[model samples]
Target: MFSIKSLHKIIFAISFTALFVVWQWYFVKSVFNFDFLARPILADGFCKDCNVILISLDNLRAKSLLCYGYEKNTAPNLCSFAGKSYLFKNVYTPSSKTQDSHFSIFTGLYPISHGMTVPFTSVLDSNIKTLPQILASNGYTTLFSGPKNDPHLPLDRGFERGFSYKDKGDEPRYWMDNMKKNNLLNRKFFAFLHTYRVHEPYIPQKENINKFYPGGPLIYVTRNDLCKKAYIKLLSQYPDRFKNLKVLNDDYCNIYRDYNTKYAATWNVEIESYLARLDPYWDAFNNLDFLVKKEYTHALYATSIYEMDLELKKFFNELENNKLLDKTIVVITADHGEEFFEHGGHSHAANLYNESIQVPLIIYIPKSKSQIVEKLASSVDIMPTILSILGIEAPEKITGIDLFSSKENKFVLAQHVTANLETIITLKWKLILNGDEKELFDLTSDPEEQIDLSIKNTNISNDLENKLNNYLFRLPKYNSIKSEPFPTWIDEEQRKKLIETGYF
Candidate 1:
């Protein structure tokens, strides 16, 4: 009953549907051959079949780990695993904050070069050369799953998958949850994991706190009550240091929160409201730290660290189980580090001190089994090294060095943003330059960065300043590197995350 044209149309529709099914089945996850989907095919044929996994722990300072120094067993499992890995003694983040630090991380350039200064509206460009792109361009599968700037899965960036916060969640719980949802809890490939539990108001539950502070009930006793007579009864039994009720008050005003007619200065951008806390402002942070420490027995802190430890055990086991362990490269580091009043700063985005810029870095080179390098290195170096190891030619524009393959690290760079242009760190010395003035520290003599030798070591200070000037001058300008603008529908959740982590 059908006309000739109608019959012809029906035949064409059936053929197209049949072709679509076959295309998906043969080309997608069902037959995910890395050479075609993610990475751009390349010549020289030296392909790294190695599964690359990069882990970034947020607000984690290197010194807190037993693997680094710290008397407390903060990262016992990490320490245990350090025996079989190459632990770098000193690794620096390029900036005191996450945006700038991560910029250096993703692009291999300094903030002075990459230009993502303020957290308000800064974004990393698409054209910027990132690690995932480099790996993907050389017949390797790439999965980028973090901040928006992460070099993966934007449909345009060539990631096999992109778990950017825009399309997915960014909480630490979401990371684990998503892994389970995707049935990737055990699947091994080039994966990057970022954690943020140690960040601010230090909100660890009281139960977790009890593990650390054994003397008290671990309850949030009001500051008013702590400064009153009743609690002082218990205090009187203790030493003179705890004698005066007012002494325990630890009261102070934070003007950073206050705005008045007396000051003529106006903010170009909205300043963050001052975060006020009780007398023991660090109660939350301590509890979280306890949770981190509890892994030895109760295993809260140790539990989280060791949870990753066991997850890693399963992870590595899966790799071995899947015949992929021998062919993998793993690098562990932090985006930015935490602050525990080392420099009178409770969190980051304050200054460029060791607590803010220094992070732990471990490179478990495949087959090498065990090695440690003491060279001063930057997070930016990881990308170049991976490219070099794979024998894939990295774009020459990168600012970082291949720490293992090259001996060129006489000095490195670190940055922070304010119109002041006040923050900087170098190999032997760390300095903060505000306009014409400077604050200097000799990191070699004082690793904790307590002693500021600006007046005493004026000569050395000047020398380092000159070195910084010449180096920065020679380095590429942030504006010079052209990059594709971020999407028009910008993700503000990422902005909120920056504020939450104190990047404001």
Candidate 2:
């Protein structure tokens, strides 16, 4: 028993076992355990009979809403609703792309966990249970209404798993009329309404436009002609920069033509749409005045938001008329925010900047006190939060916490895998990591993220980078499901719709 060699082997074995145990604990805590200050109180069956409605406004930015401190009153109805709802001041999406972020919202998992980080390419893992599936299992009628041909949310692509009813269009009135006709309004239900009306090609009605932009109507023909003229002028002025500009059908006028002329009559064309189609020729806009472009785009976008607000007001009024308002819990949010050249990008799926990741989150719980919550939240938190309010238990492995609970997350993470960008954000500090590049911003002092303090704040930057790296590395080990390739069944017509919606 006192032999030296035998004693040495025992000590070695014990040391190895201890190290393995420690490593195992760290891996589990980092990957599966969502750090919370305390256990969330499960109010089981508290809202068992309440109806849940989740409205996702495609590409709607928080700053575009009046309640979020936008200069213009772009969404008056939503603002009024916010007065009686819980408005989250800082809610960030896990990804800037529509498909990825929506997947996170439905599964209560981040892009890395759910494996839908790529836009129009990555299919959600089959093993991940969606919120709709859980709600439907709990005796709730699940409904979905959105663009029928939306390539980002194809019914066959796991999105139609639990939906008992689905609409081919994104119109609220159409959805409501159908619900009433089907006698679904009286049941305990979970309805998800999504729309791209306020997205790119912002074409608000003439009346709605006049309310925001007092400058008469923005004639499409005139704007189209002007853009063509500007491009021509730029080609002649900056031959070197415009040498590779491609003209369609040998006519510059046809350069910005819709992909499908047959659908042009129904297609809402706008100056923004034309400009977006000029990708690869984005430099052609250099000849135009920057301030003019910004102002014009902002005005059009504002009008679109206002138009949606009016639609929402009508929808809410109908719910009240049907005596369903008091029994309904409404959750209003956006897939992600749109970027208007904030970081040299026109639309989303390009970067993880604040404009692309920050969105408004409003929850209207019947009889709950209305107040502005200053806590930081994420898109992944939506599923768990909704389930908690409905008194349903969330999946044990999810990364989201009940937003209403006293538990708080140390940080929220956002990533745009297509762009190879990732960010870890706290209430004050935000660290963006791209390959070896790093950017740290003090959100409290520089909410716009104008300055880079990574070099000056090395300590903070290093700490965040380490944490982010640890989390990312631990994910693959725990995630059993792998992302699948884009389905081949998506037809050419659907591809056209996706392009028209700026998802190309």
lDDT of each: 0.56, 0.75
Model 2 misplacement above 4 A = 1-45, 119-121, 217-287, 476-504
Per-model TM against the reference: 0.65, 0.77
Per-residue CA lDDT of candidate 1, range 1-504, in tens? 999999999999999999998888677745654234444222222335566767677667787677787656656555655676778878888876765666577678877777766543454554566676566555544444454433211222222223222224334444444444554434434556555555443444435444444542334433333224323332343335233223323431212112212222422111212122322444433555544333222223332343444444554455456554466666778867766556554567556677777899987656665766678788888777666656667767788876655344677777666434444455577776767877788777888878878888888778878888898888776452223444333247534434444454
- The lDDT, on a scale of 0 to 1, for candidate 1 is 0.56
The predictions' CA RMSDs to the true structure, in order, are 20.0, 10.2
The TM-score obtained by model 1 is 0.65
When summed lDDT is taken over every stretch of 10 residues in candidate 1, the lowest stretch is: 252-261
lDDT of 2 by residue, 40-108 (tens): 433545566799989898899998888998888998898998898889999999988787788889998
Q: At residue 492, what lDDT does model 1 achieve? A: 76
Predicted structure with the largest lDDT when compared to the true one: 2
